[model samples]
Target: MKKYTLLLVLFFALTNAFAQVKTQYFDENWKPVIQEDMVYYRPEPKAVNGKYLFKDYYKSGKLQFEGFSLSKTEEKFDGEVKYFAENGKISGTSEFRNGVLDGSVKTYFEDGRLRQDATVKNGEEESAVLYTYKGTDINGSLSLYDLMTFFDHDERVKQIIYDGDPKGIRQESYLSEGKAKYYGPDGKLLGELIFDLYGNPNNGTMIEFDFNPMKVSATRVFVDGKEQQLEKI
Candidate 1:
């Protein structure tokens, strides 16, 4: 009689454990989506309390990206994200806060050299130090949110620094001093220009240089606070 009682108790315990495991498997909301070798989870009820996993795959059956979102619903990303190259190597990694980039982001070259290490705040570029694949500093201590402006679409410039005190509501007048500098991709100073306190290049000297081998190429100076081209004798 005691043996029968013990057997009955063990059977009930196993039955309860199996029921709990089945309950945790997934509700009707989660549907497995398989595209080629990629798999993803899509919540049926757009809003539900749970953690969701996301993934992408390369055509060769390798993982391209993997990340997760934590919330009461599967809305926005709020955790770590990773990316991979076609060769299945990690290419980049970043953290996200509510779907916006909020922390450190690092990228690497195909050869595994660190390409960039930068920070972002509220989805805007805050500060950065650029480098070459060979691990050389192309530009150091770059503060994009503080004092910098790009005229040409390309931003390989070091000149035209904006000195301003952005303290209050009037941001336009905060630009105290303005100066422009130009540099070559080889990291040599090429030219310089001056601008008004308000960042206008109306009455300023512009210097040009020849950096194939560093030297001064030409000079243009503004006179009478007006536009005039100087003719060489």
Candidate 2:
């Protein structure tokens, strides 16, 4: 009798799980669309809650991009979004936090060589490098976001420095006095900061990019007429 009851419960659980999912299709604008008009589509909606898996396709019906969204027709995206070429090679991947691109994002060559590698936070591309298909490194940070076949945000670069454990440094106006102290590789000095006559926080003088999403908090070390804030994010 207990075994029979268990089987009944299991059946209902699986049925409900399947029912929760609903398939959706849409046009380029993400409006409610018919099967023939859809440029984008969703998984049969089941088991998805706050985030829904969504995909856009090329006219050839090859997946052009895929990501998670808050709803069927809206792209308030969260988590990692991926792009692909018609040939199905992954062209790029961008990590999004509440619809804003954040963390380590990269693009690749068809042959799978690294094409672009970047670190971003709060919709800002703090540092990035672009590589030619032939492997020449080019500055593809900030001003170049639009040229890429992805999303766009206006980034004004102050400076870019190569850094580690997957981190890069940038300088800003507020750090005119203070310095950036980096402790890593088991707490050794990776400090690259400036000491103002009064001391404060950064730009070309300091900052890092991480998809590892290191603990970052902006705490004010000093407050003056300008009230410059220090961000250790």
Which numbered prediction scores highest in TM-score against the true structure? 2
Candidate 1 per-residue lDDT, tens place, 65-115, comes to 677666423436777788888887899988899888888778887877665
Question: TM per model?
Answer: 0.41, 0.42
Please list the residue runs of candidate 1 whose C-alpha ends up more than 4 Å from where it truly belongs after superposition: 1-55, 67-80, 88-90, 98-100, 106-119, 122-178, 182-192, 196-201, 211-215, 223-233
* Model number with the top lDDT: 2
Model 2, CA-based lDDT: 0.58
Candidate 1 vs. true structure, TM-score: 0.41
Model 2 root-mean-square deviation: 14.6
Error of 1 at 27 (Å): 24
lDDT score, candidate 1, position 188: 50
Q: After superposition, how far is residue 128 of candidate 1 from its true place, in Å?
A: 7.3
